[model samples]
Target: MKKLLAMLLVICSTASAEIQPEPIGRIQTLPDPYPPHWIVAVDVAFFHMNDGKLIVLDADSDDPAGRFKGMMNGTFIPVMYMAETRPEIYVLESFRARGHRGERTDVMTIYDKTTLAPIDEVVIPAKRVSAMPTEYYLQLVDDEKLALIYNFTPATTVSVVDLEKREFLGEVPIPGCSLIYPLAGRAFASLCGDGKLLTIQLDRNGKLVSSERTEAFFDADNDPLMEKPAIIDGIAYFPTFLGNVFPVDLSGSAPVIGESWSLVEGVEGGWRPGGIVLAQGDASGRLYVLMHPDGHDGTHKDPGSEVWVFDPQTKQRVDRIELALPAITMGLTNDDDPLLVTTNINLEVDVYNANSGEHLRTIGNFGQETVFLFHSDR
Candidate 1:
């Protein structure tokens, strides 16, 4: 009887410890009913500058799917999304061991898409440019094989990283130039301070194969091109501050400067180009330019009240989109029915039909100030 009681007690103890699995505190993921097209907005809080975040929103529903914060070292840094490869996002940021006064460690952190967790990180030896955030600061080249990150410690240089090998190769000096535009193969073009284009060709090992400079293309001081250009089929359409469209051919070995044309014709009160995303290109080779009336000097960064769609082939304004709110940046999805998305100064994202220019919806009071808007389809 004593043995029977002991065995029964052991069984009861085991049964008590094995509690029934409850639905509470369990992990579950429902199907994503939203469309695949995504809009990545880098929100750099002007007031709370240290609390910057990369917010990814579904273009179809205007719902945020993920948010990445505290990775940018309390500064506004550029982040690139790699959709073609193993599905990861790359951020060019700095880290200091002993706070702001310590030696800075420039690194690129790769985050997983599903969990938004850091999967890999590679240290960049060269100091990266930490001025205003621009997409040209970091770009993936050769079908996502190499990542070329621009560095500017007052002197221009590019840090090359082999993404496939997951290693930093080296830095290439680009004197008297700023910004990067990836050309055919492993070559890239930079905008020179003296109104010229500098093209640098690199071998697989990140060594300089050839470097060339074009003639002074645009007036850098009077009418400069915006850092962000609309690239389509190895051609970059640069919009000048005074509403001029400049195209540069990057298909060949050397840079070819195409004819420059004005975006506005005989407008009343000085219509000029303005906004963070001054211009964007669609898959059909149409260029979308943001325009503001009564623009003056130092007004290049102002919000645009109108969006003009133009065809680069014909150089004509095909359609005009009257924005419901003034936009500081704009992006477009590349789906069958493309959506023109714009972020206003009020930190709200306005979605519109790309073809009809009809207002679709407004999303976000998410308590973040957005600086740049990028489309996943790009």
Candidate 2:
């Protein structure tokens, strides 16, 4: 009996051995890529819309002072929308101003990064309904091909384009969904005028093999902040306007929504949750959920918001950072960098230490005003 117990103990110990997955490195370049030393990409508000330009700011020059000074004054963009290689930037333009009267045509300009000059300009096709400014999110799946999501209703379609030849490979119809976010060889999209999330998969022949509804919303007509699903560690994090966060597991035979997280912890619960960013360091641990207190009136106007950070591992609310100004959008600087909140107040981006809610740096209207990307030089 004693000898049998010893063998069982040994078997249990071996079963407990943990197999760790590789950490995803800081996203440096896209599939086929080239990037400058500093300033990965800046999303700026151009032509009155969120259409921003990507400017390269490198101070490691013969004349550091001169190079630094030159950055303050925007440089001519080689690419409009920052992509993988030859095309570093793709700027989707909108001619008409919001609430402005009448129809208008627009052009999307592509630029090269090294030279900061225009490479190609294509006219964005008009939509049947009232048009709004949207980005043509492009992903270079491989060396020769790219997955492109053209933004515009009626004209909205996901297609594969030949990078070398700029040839239209083919377009796949995404009914009910208007926005397509391409990541990890699959596209996660949300139905237009609805909060339902859908998953689209493409086979080797570039044909969209299966399209399935991943998650349905609480309300059919409710606009759920309309943001891209954060895909991290093979798990897609979906934070809804209703203060719910879904961590979907993709490792299984079929992807399943593992856990539902509530950002604001209270008897009544949180609402209008936006800007959900994943925590760094300990893998499969914490996730930061930014909540906007726009009490269910359905109008998205909120005065001053608070970010409630939660630890998924512990399944608890970690901390809260009250923003003096109302946050328009939020992002991260480093893997461990604090939450970078962008406010419409001063159009400034403030960085807070993720854990302690300490203000690190307010990268004020230093570069771009809108949704900005913070990359670590470390």
Candidate 3:
């Protein structure tokens, strides 16, 4: 019996060694510029902040394995931005020499879009915001020639770097404002604490040329607008805590504040916009907002159960998409036919047809926390 068992085991091991994978040392690469329908979901990994990840999924495919493009590391609550002209992905991240307790170093790591590998890194200030990552934090302005990194050490300031020269230019102090809103030519704006927009203009050398603030646009104490906005063709559509859209035209040197409109007129259930990513826009110039029922104080950060679609031109609710699951974060691709990407209540990623308002499928949870979604061709 022992001899027979030995013989069987030897035969099984010999057979397994005979069949080997055919491909030998072949590396796979993604397209130079990713498809416009691709979605990049950023996971902050609250359980373990040191191991953050940025997952890329193909929204056009329903297959679990087939739609997964690839992923890259987003160490330490990194903020991401996709480059339009270059085939590069920029991540503003921080590192500690002792794995969480040493001299902290922050850098702008430039990754190759094709290989999904870090190609170069430009060192910046160590004061990058360590809180929740948002779309307006690290913005590329000045025709994508300059990169602005938002910093907060209990005080607000912006660090400007010349991406073309790969050098840190200087820091601009924005003491009372928050978030970066790119303006026309060498300028950007931020929302002030007093319900106003402060515009900052810079020169070719990245030095501050002028700064101005608009009159109180909205009542900050009573009704505050969500800093996140859907920017379409240089117009920012920002939603208030209640359900109103405030349009700001950023096509000129200074921001032109347009009239505000209500989105929940005649609608029921007390629907109001709320979520980490409150609003997004599709390629057809339509606005999509995450909404929840029975909204109240402190409910502004709650996950939304429905998505309200509206025509920016008409400012009317065209369609409302009932979410398959409550979503905490949301994003939309910039394609003609777009896919609504979101991180649901269970931390899972869900895809829906933007035009038809159909629940496509859920991609399952990729990490402990996915707070932001980035969309673009690159």
TM-score to true structure, per model = 0.86, 0.63, 0.92
Among all windows of ten consecutive residues in candidate 3, which has the lowest summed lDDT? Answer: 365-374
Q: What local distance difference test score does each model get?
A: 0.77, 0.48, 0.87
Instruction: Kindly list the per-residue Cα lDDT of model 1 for residues 265-362, writing each as its tens digit.
Output: 76676888888887887777788988899898999989999899998889899999999999998888766577888888787888888889999888
For model 2, residues 1-378, the per-residue Cα lDDT tens digits are 999999999998888885767788733322223222233334445443333544333322334333222121122111123454444454444455443445655444555544445566554443312232223243444432554545446655665554455444566777776654444554444354454556666665567777777556435455353344454565656666566666666443345656566655573543566431222221334555456654575533343366666666566776677766656555443334234434434665555555677665454434554433322221
- Cα lDDT of candidate 1 equals 0.77
The positional error of residue 31 in candidate 1, measured at the CA in angstroms, is: 9.2
Which residue pairs come into collision in candidate 1?
none
Q: What are the per-model numbers of colliding residue pairs? A: 0, 17, 0
lDDT of 3 by residue, 60-148 (tens): 77777777788889889878888888888899889999998999999999988888899988898898989877889988887899998
Worst 10 residues of 2 by lDDT: 70-79
Cα lDDT, model 1, residue 90: 84
Superposed by TM-score, candidate 2 places the C-alpha of residue 270 at a distance from the truth, in angstroms, of 5.5
Error of 1 at 312 (Å): 0.9
